[model samples]
Target: MSTWKETLFGDPFAVEGDEIDETAQSEAELLAKGNVFEQPAATRGELWGYYLYYNGDNGFTMNSYMPNILQSLAYMGGFYYDGNTTAQNCNNMPEGAVCYVPWAGGSIPVASMLLYIQAIAFSIQFVLFTTFGSLGDYGRWNKWILLSATIIGCASQIIPMVWVNNDGSQWNGMMGMMCIALISYGASLVFYAAAFPLLADNLPVVRKARFDPNVSREDYVLVAEKWRNNVSAISTTFSNVGFLIVTAVLSGASFAPWEKYDFPDGVAHILGNAPIFNYIATVFCGGFWIINAIPYFLWVPAGRGGPQLPPGENHLTIGWKNIISSLREARKLRYLFMYIIAYFIFSDAVNTLNSMIGIIQGQITSFNGTQITILNLVSAVCSIIGCLAFLWIQRWFKIRTKTNLLIIIVLTAIVPIWGSIGIGSTKFGIHNTWELWVFYVWSGIFIAPIWAWQQTMLAELVPKGKENLFFGLFGVVNKASSWIGPVVIGAITQSTSNLWEGWPFVLGLFLIAIVIIFFIDVDKAKEDIRLYLLENSDEASVNGQEKSIHSVHDTDRPVSAKDEKFV
Candidate 1:
């Protein structure tokens, strides 16, 4: 068997079963003698790449631009073209000429247009994800694919700077720019997620002759699990840290001026000035993303390099077939399917809330750009803390994943409830903006832990040897209903001309998710996975070779379909 270094950092161009040179083999042995931990070098590099990727992507998309900067730009666009200048219709706009509709033709509501654009963008992303998601599983060029997608995504981010005009009057191309960016971003993520299991599967086994050679296979499994969890936690923590840093820097620079109060024609106007900040910030974010992705391209291995398709079968054919097969197999894994449903509903609410909060905050509380930045900064800090706390609780207190999820689900229900009530009335004693700030921060504290644990749970439950395909489905579940919440909220806000009314829709989504989650049996789902692997072990071999990392022990354990029971 090859040493870890030879297997991981071996020639990217090398095909499976390629003969190794004698000199290279000798060197691999020499390196293995001094290596203590036996961890794969390529695995370490991928972990670092994962950190940098999240830092750049999450910093720009989730923390800085999507929720904060982009919303401001949309608000400004609406002010200039939406034709709603009345105080009631334009409550979020700053004073003076800021509310003037400069565009000549009849205009749609900003919320409506924004939602339409998002719906279209995500729809395209869903298609692209289906096409590209499984390619990494078959092809040896996954790194090239990933790099191409990232470069395309980065380019899309820069396009908006040119298309979104400063005055918002010439922003007709912004929609197209956003759509392209969203599609590229979504495609990139599919491959990024597919890499996780590949890395996990390729961890170098410790040789018995050298280090703890008598270590049981069960202990190796445990060690692998520890590595997976640590990588997950570290990636999550770094993402939040990166977001916080970016938010602080941008906020401190006062890149965009606060909405200013102005009176014109005896009507108060809340003017949205300094529209150029959006363009500058987005450009900077795009540059940051590309620069940070270099490490990933250089370090992380591409495909698993274990197997390939039969003659005449390429990535496209294999990818589509896998997608269909996975869907069909979902019926056999009913509990896992239910978990996906639960995840869909809750994720929809979470994503919608993330997309619309800046607009909602501006409307309800008149929070300016600086205030929004601060809000995101606070959220980033809280998320980091929450992840660490959850890790600690799980490690030390030994809380079950299901119980922890239930608690988080219950806690998260407070977010939309407080928003709807606080914005609609002072009955909940949330009469002031500071109270709203507190509510937002409280919600942020729970958000990170929920996602961190959710990913861990899914990673645990996914059927072995099918991580790429299942994670692809997970991505679908995540993005599929994602457009629904935004569309519903946007339509409700437009129809009622009241943004506060949309909060109830989000509240309902969360409640439905919470209900569905109660039916998920974590232990039973894990057992089902084990049984499936036991039955299909031979069939799962690639190229007549057993390459699956999911090994079932010979020891007897509970195995029965009837044994499946909800917790």
Candidate 2:
């Protein structure tokens, strides 16, 4: 008769204080009575709008700007220190460089400067995530925060255009611009991720039907799980689509007519002659991001009143407290905590790869702009295929989430190994550019499902109402180690003066993640969250405290029905 018992076993025939009826209702009748098929049209529309816009921005940043920025920095650093002013060498350099290089005497090493910038950006992001992560849980400004961060983040991309000189010789405040842009981009992501749970919970359709009078607790859970899975899959797909579009556009722009067109002095100066395609492509991608993101601000509602703030504490105080509480609670949630550790390790490898791959390709393979664009386009296409395939395999075949993730982790491990050892080594005969292309495309296929699965699993395991707080914790775990990988890799590469050697560190991180993931008990983690919410629901209500619950969307509904009987 306990909550956990009812949840684990079906309670289809049980009614309040009444004997079970042998044939109370057919399964189809029960489903209809519960309104399981009543989709929330408005909610779906909002989700679609937000997902489309957000994913578009995400794609533009990842496919266009992020790579462009990192490559630009590397090229500029080379220009400054080595005085390599070749067309490819100066192609992506920041502005103001034409007026101000050769720094009087000496310049910092490119690798060292890159590592330092990464560290500073991630450190700032960690502080911001710690402070702003829980704002949505307490205040009515979630949407505003998301909007402002996104706008500023997008606007930051334009700074290089204005400040960097066209000639690739000098740029005023180039370092400052890079730092600000990174920080702003990082801040926007925290807000963007924090918004996911809200979107999942607040779908008017799900909220309305979740509390059907005739619905069994098990049935309700089934519905909620379906929604979570559907949303997660769809969101991921949209993100991939966004990446694909950006890649296609950029790749297409590399062709003859566009390549031959003469840009204005300011534009041409920012874009350089080595590969004029990148400059115009970057600006086009930035514009794409800003224009696409408008719908998210317009369509998504923020902070639809849930938990009240604790007495005498504002969101800032509560945000800090939430971080502390999550850390303290980690000991109690062993499986969840372990999973986070695993996520941190693997994520470090993934993040480092994303941030550094362009630099590696440019420096090691001497890839031209056309080649790079084609490579990105192939990767983007593969990513889309991977996401879609994952959804099919999971839904049609019904594989366990942990099992699928492990498979992905193992496959992903192959990439670093291939890159570090197989590519140019005598052992593998993969010495050609086409072979390298195959390896990269293989990597893209495996990497695409990682974020989708990771986010879905975290959503599955997080305590219900405190998504923002836990996601903040997720962000903390993520960003805390973000810079470490880059720093270690950069240090190793610089010390050895070999880019290939640093990649083994990435392979090791992934292997460690695989081992840790093997020990995580997903079912036990979900159970712990359910039990915790059940035990604390009453106390939270009486004390006017905020705690995890079944759904943030259903906060206004009676708790005794769902909390006591279902969750």
lDDT of 2 by residue, 436-535 (tens): 5875677567776787677667767677666545665776787787788878876675565445566788889999999998888888888998787777
lDDT agreement of model 1 with the native: 0.58
lDDT of 1 at 216: 45
TM-score of each: 0.73, 0.73
> Which TM-score value belongs to model 1?
0.73
Per-model lDDT: 0.58, 0.59
Report the poorest 10 consecutive residues by lDDT, candidate 1: 558-567
Model number with the top lDDT: 2
Per-residue lDDT tens digits for candidate 1, residues 161-271, read: 664445444444555666677777766665665565445434443222113334344564554444454445455556556666667776765543344433245432322
Instruction: Please list all clashing residue pairs in model 1, or write none if there are none.
Output: 93-270, 94-269, 94-270, 94-271, 95-269, 95-270, 95-271, 208-213
Q: How badly does each model clash, as a count of residue pairs?
A: 8, 11
